[model samples]
Target: MYKKVALAIAFSPTIEALISETKRLVELFGSELILIHIGKKTDELETQLEEIIIKTGLDILNTKLIWKEGKPVHMILEACAEEKADLLIIGALKREGILTYYLGSVGRKLIRKSKCSILTLIDPRVEAERFSKVVVNGTQMEITPKVISKALKFCQIENVSQVHILNEIKLYAFRMATASKGSEDEVSNTRRKLIQDEIVYVQDILKDLDKTGLKINIKITAGKWAVELVRYCEAFKADLLILGDERGYTFIDRLFPHDLEDVLSELPCNLLIIK
Candidate 1:
């Protein structure tokens, strides 16, 4: 689905691993790779980047390298827009501290404001690893089908074996169902019915998808969406988690902490946020 993939390059310890992952994604998606570095252009830096590209098995001549001097977040987002990047890959910490939540980090800012889809690697390795288990947010939204489709496309390309689609039942709905003066058995039945309905909803979405060679598992979860999502991913030992950003997030939402914010604060796995 990604026609052009971009990597926000930083000469950090994970640079080699990041480049290797980016190269693999570009080759898999059949996309033009764009490397964006937010720093002054220097011959030494250029040479180093070239060496890394060659070492990572990416053709330096074929890759588009961009060097710009500006703020890291602004420059990276600008480059992604200018390059018309369908997907932007960047390295991210597995979990950010409390200070980062309020102050905002480069990775979080990019996730909040970037116009294109983003893939944040929590633990990038020099030797790229395969994504065998994938968990997709099957929340009931207009953008859910598109998110699932993109996830399935990636799974087909990567040959993922296990795919779990998680649909969450809102806590408020459950509260409302039990608010009525009902017996314990009635409340239990209400919860069971809610879970069944969510399963059917997810199945309907998957009915039109091409699930070839994939073991599809539909899970109906309850409680806070983001917290439950993280718990599910951890429990399932998912290598990748795909989520749909139907509506862009705002600063107020960040302060109050919404579903996306909760997930962003502590990534359970390599996150793929589809816009």
Candidate 2:
């Protein structure tokens, strides 16, 4: 049922693994694969890409190859919007340079701002997580029935049990009282406001999801959004983590770092990012 997917391949060592995983995903979901190669303009690389395609037997008609002369993240976002892709697949190479990868430098940029769901391949040797034991993370109220239905289909295919819903809400309190003065009332009021807002937000989301017949475990948490989400995945022994990515070009995303450190770094399980 997942028809359109945009795959951002670095054309590095992960290409072979990516192709193999693509085959598995297509077989499982019956979706179209748009393979994109991001690198400096070079005909040799293109030829190499083709050779790999032939070698891997990823010669399907639905597969596409794009050679763009720009930053990888920007070109990827453009492609997603143009193709109306439902998902984005990229490779995460874990190396010694952690700090450089952070601070909005490389692939992390796309991870933060991608409009469609993102599936990051952690190890070239490993592909595909459990079809069952899936975890869903997002605002419950915003999740559509169609999305839930699709998720259910995946669960059924994988024979999964226990879908955990993650709710993330943070609270902050402060006032500029000469940088030294603090008011107890101000702190108390801020706490009260945070609690009230969280209650309202969660209530609305829960009401909508209640309509779905799927049984799920509700997990309410506060603090950093992506970190806690990954933690829950680890604790529950979830095989897959599902998230919803918004579509289209987002100006704000480029300005900030992608907040999926735990999900990418501590990839104890596979990730399924859906739009």
Candidate 3:
């Protein structure tokens, strides 16, 4: 559960869904909610936001509404940072174009830029569902522990019975680059040992989770990351997927402005990205 939640609101279809999900999360974590709207502040927009708050059933908590004038992405990120939000919830929609792998939508940008965790709902209409099973990626070995630690906090609150860990080593990149240093057999052994070592390391790091009494399974595969993850999650009916960002961003770019669009399409459930 998060301590503070920052919700970026725009006049879009995802607003209602975002608010609805926000209400559920607020109820779950008893967390403070900060509502941010970036646009020309107007009486009409205030009335609309008020109505939205009422509709969201946020009357139970003293929620704060902030109106600022600036670019949407800039204002949203600023508000989240100012509030020290542990969890930032936003929506993602595909843009109209040739559909490049890098879909630099505001949500994707926020996921990349924000230092905290983010929950992205690609579809506005999908209702907020309780998480029963969680799938967390461990490919970013350095950040895997933190990601799983946060996921375990949710599991403790949500009573998640199972967690699926995916550590996908990019075989395509490996064949081209990793083979440069070692013989065929050496490379094969190294690849096999990588997964074997990860299993032992992750299990050791997550020993505390075992006390929670949830069934945990970690598997390392060599293949396409996005394709295999989508296939595995769909088969298992994952309620939420958590991933970590490990790459260093060098610019005013919204988190990995290049690779996100290709990696994330529509998911069977929600996505939580921890930076």
Candidate 4:
């Protein structure tokens, strides 16, 4: 569960979803809410924010809305850090002609740069929204335990009934794609054993969370991780997706699945990325 949630607000169609999601979380965690909007403090913007506040029933005394002038990603990240926020929620700004709504420049930057967790809503106004079905990727070998523990705790608090751990087989296959294997049968056997081992590992990892009454599942799929992960989420109708940041935050330095550009671009559900 998050303690302090900072909302990165902007003047776009995405703002309403940001506000709505923020409101839900604020109520859920009773979190200290901080709204950061990066732009000139214009009277028009002030009136717009006022309307949002009224609609969301935000207690002005508790909610802090900061209007800053500068680069949006930098300011939002800075503000959240200064406020000691645990999670930062932002909407995915759709780029025209893109099959999926890719994170806007600011959002992409934040995911890469922000030290705290980020929740990106692909489309915010769902008829009914609950993170009942959640998926978390456990491919970052270094942080698998930390990520799983964090995700389990989140699921326990969010009342998530079903949770999935996505494990990828990217090592040998990527290398073998160019070279010939010893034999078809040998390769198949090796792959099957790998899958079984992965399941055992995931089951062991999830033992501590079993008492939480959460249904845990492990999926071992071939091909690029981003592609397999996104396909599983779409087929499963996952409500929220969680992944860790193993790479740097700059647009070029991130670990966004080199072959799966459309993973975020055409994502089928909301996403929560942690560093």
Instruction: Return the top candidate by lDDT.
Output: 1
Off by over 4 Å in 2: 40-43, 97-104, 124-130, 138-150, 157-162, 168-215, 220-225, 245-268
lDDT of 4 at 268: 67
What is the lDDT for 67 in model 4? 84
Task: Give all TM-scores, in the order shown.
Answer: 0.92, 0.66, 0.80, 0.86
Tens digits of per-residue lDDT, candidate 1, 112-219, equal 788999999887888998899999998777778889998998999999999999998878899999998999999999999889889988888789989899988988
Clashing pairs for model 4 are: 100-265, 112-249
Per-model CA lDDT versus the true structure: 0.85, 0.64, 0.73, 0.77
* Model 1 spans with C-alpha error above 4 angstroms: 94-104, 248-257
- Report the lDDT of model 2 for residue 125: 47
Order the candidate numbers by TM-score, best to worst. Answer: 1, 4, 3, 2
Give the per-residue lDDT of model 2 (tens digit) for 1-275.
66787777776777878877776776677788888766685878878877877777775565776666687789888988888887787766665665311122566677667777777665544354445567766443344333454566666655566677666555332233223555777666665665566556545555654334445665666666578877787788776777655333355333223555555656656676665
Please give, for residues 170-251, the per-residue lDDT of candidate 3 as tens digits: 5665576565777888888767766677677778768876437567788777765556676677788887888777655333
Candidate 4 residue-wise lDDT, 173-253, digit = tens: 635643664687776776777777777776777776544678888888766677777888989989888877665544533
Worst 10 residues of 4 by lDDT: 252-261
lDDT of 2 at 115: 72
- Number of the predicted model whose TM-score against the real structure is largest: 1
